[model samples]
Target: MKKQLATALAALVMAPAMSATSVDLGYKAYTSDTKSDNGGAYDQPFVKLTHFNKADWGTLLAYVKLENPGEVKDAQHGKDGKLTVKSLLIVDKQIGDTSYNFWGQNFLVSNRTVMEDNLYLGVTTNRKYGALFINAGVGLNYSAAHFDPTGASFDGISGYAAVINARYPFSAMGLKHSLSVNYEGQIDRDEDHMSTLGYDSYGHQIITTLKTSMTESFYTKLHMTHFDSWGAAPNDGIEYGVAVGFTF
Candidate 1:
């Protein structure tokens, strides 16, 4: 999965280089404390890549997160070097303040083959009110998940998904800050609800992120997310993380 994601990111980076729009790369450290050992006090180091186009199409983002990088020696699997990779691609057609888009996202976790992927058709609109700038979007999505952690093949579990995202930004003291919220709900196919052990295979998640700019190209952010499950989705807990980012 990591190799595949790296290839995809390379393609995205090269596709628009002739135009040479804009690119940013940054490193972040994330930590969380939760009741579950899976989500407990763990440190994650991640690298992020983002590309923006001068043309009409939107942005492409790719990132990889490694849990407990280089700390515990000789250990393996979930405790030592768990890997997570994510990628997103957005293509948009804009008409004034509104933009219609088709987007796709892929997520994978290592030491296992649990993967989630989704595609969405959405519209986004931006507006300004007083000193605040607001951006919002909604999408209809189709999602699929595979949970063969041991490499055994299984039937793909499919679902219908809905997504919403909103952001509000304002400036103060010559610095910019923004609050962003995102929500996703996936409802599994009725037949697949009980496919993953005895648990329902669908999930709903909400995340809020607050970012404050330190400089024109550097920022600090805090993210909080809550996962709700109808039956027994994997991400059924709360997580909080802080990150620092830079753009050039």
Candidate 2:
């Protein structure tokens, strides 16, 4: 599955007029309060790949979190992390100051993990005001669960959510920078499971990101995310990560 996804993304990026296509590869480290049984923390490293405007189609993005290559396993399904793939399509329709977007994303957690797969379909619109850009959208989400070998099995669940985002551009430390905030709320159902399977009761999430342009084709970002939920596994913790990317 991972190979297939990589191949498809490469094909799209290498299509005609490929020089116009841009790709960024970055490294990210995430720290969370969640811990494993052996008192080891759930901090992990990830490799992120992003492709923009391939064949005038859309942007393709993917990331994979990895466990230490030679780390010892504490359980059958060790603390291996997650993989996520996102495809964003621009509608190319500009009404006054707003532009439209349609997007889809797939989330795949480690094998035997609680959250098996999450699929999303959404439409969004954005507008700019001075140095600020705002976005709003609605989306449908479907989440599947992993079967616990020694616990109760779970089935797939589906729901819908609303999203809003705000971004401000500024200059700091003699570098071009931007600050963005995003919020997603589950209005139709309070148990959408956008983040996790067993943690399905999460109704909302908030994310804040600070990014700086290091060069014409390079940049860096620092981000923090929080999940709100009241489920069996309450994922009400904060996750933070730092990343650096370069475009070609």
Candidate 3:
């Protein structure tokens, strides 16, 4: 009974994670860009959907999210690996970018205005232990990005984010605790940067995570990510969730 309860509690904390078949929504409080002119509401809704088939169940698949704010209210639909259609590209792009795409793999991608009209491509592969995954890619925006230009703020950038993670089963609580470091950079385009073409960046970086599990189905998930640019001071924010969830 205690084990079952523990699992249930863990699931509760992990609810926001395993929603591959249901619609989910949430809102936030302290975002720098939260529009006060739009409405009296302080909460910007966190709404999304998840749908997957057996083919995509076990692997860790991340999104190269995009966003186009005024162009769409936010809607994404897909039946399988093929997307029905979505404007998340607009959203992903609008959220802001400070990293270069990878040259090999892509786990979670969001480059709004790196090149313009053109979306980047990426590839990723994991180590045998699943403890390490290396990703690389190149991004050429279809349009040049001038962030906050005209006060309209068209955020655009291209960079790569690499995450190395390790997890071990916590026997005491029947849980798995994971720790990771996600690093990103822009492709330097100069003779001096040629030595580091695959490296260098305008840094805006931070530590992030999902932890504190007392139940197999419930845990407290915490998220915070930040990156830096030449003129832009690094920005960061935190997201918290307590809900029930599971891997299988």
Candidate 4:
């Protein structure tokens, strides 16, 4: 069946990403106001956490991933918060089974942050979709977001994004700034999302992160994407915001 094939292919593709010795976890919270409701999950904001790590096995390696996520909203308040959990894994091996270097990817899915179950792809050893996605051994970061204003089906509002980035410690100033240029698109919806005549609305975003600083063990700060929806204001209203994060 198609499902089984997809699962098998996903496992093969994820083999390389899980071959590392360390892992990192990140969380973020953001809020924005958009115009209408597309009946889809748009500006339906929430909190989320994602993690990835590497392992070593003389000739083969195991790459693991996990994410715990949550979200709150401004549109349709009662149906506001949706929570979900997911697990991801992959492996890696030398290209010719001779050398010690290798590469791979990961497959992750969620019910809360996803609709009808979707598969997301990621790379390891700094490779993305066959592209050289590394600035300094860090990694590439990207996300797709949408906000719909019209209370329609799957047609009215949507957003998409792609960004490749890296970061390192700056001991001198106790600060680290990640920089990237990302492209994003926002699409509007109609009453029937899967319909042929579904031309509702859309917009684009090009953004950059200016700086990030760690003031203490309990706090860190950063800024990103001063986005202005292009053409027709795809979803609602938002350019960028200041972000502050803390951990125990």
Error of 3 at 41 (Å): 16
In terms of lDDT, the best-performing candidate is 2
Put down candidate 3 lDDT per residue, 162-210, tens digits, no spaces. 3333333333456665544454444432322212111134333444544
Local accuracy of candidate 2 as per-residue lDDT tens digits, 1-248: 99999998887557734433344333333333433221222444444544434244433444444343223234224644333333332222223443666756565554433435556678777678998988787778665555455444444546676678899999988999989998876544324233334344436768899989899878888887765652111445565677777766
Candidate 1: clashing pairs of residues: none
Rank candidates, TM-score, best first: 1, 2, 3, 4
Q: What lDDT does model 1 reach?
A: 0.54
Residues 193-248, candidate 1: write the lDDT tens digits: 33542335556778898888888777888887776652112435666677777666
Q: After superposition, how far is residue 86 of candidate 4 from its true place, in Å?
A: 6.2
Worst ten-residue run, lDDT, model 2?
A: 32-41
lDDT (Cα, tens digit) per residue for candidate 4, span 1-248 = 99999997766656644532433334333333433323222333223333334433312323332322345443244455444443433333434433323332233333433421112222223333333233211122222222233333232222222223343333345565544454434344223432321333343455554435454333333334333433212233343444444432
Candidate 1 global TM-score: 0.64
State in Å the error of residue 188, model 3. 3.7
Q: What is the C-alpha RMSD of each candidate to the true structure, in Å?
A: 7.9, 7.7, 15.0, 10.3
> What is the clash count for each candidate, in the order shown?
0, 0, 65, 31
Question: Candidate 4: deviation at residue 200, Å?
Answer: 12
lDDT of 1 at 245: 71
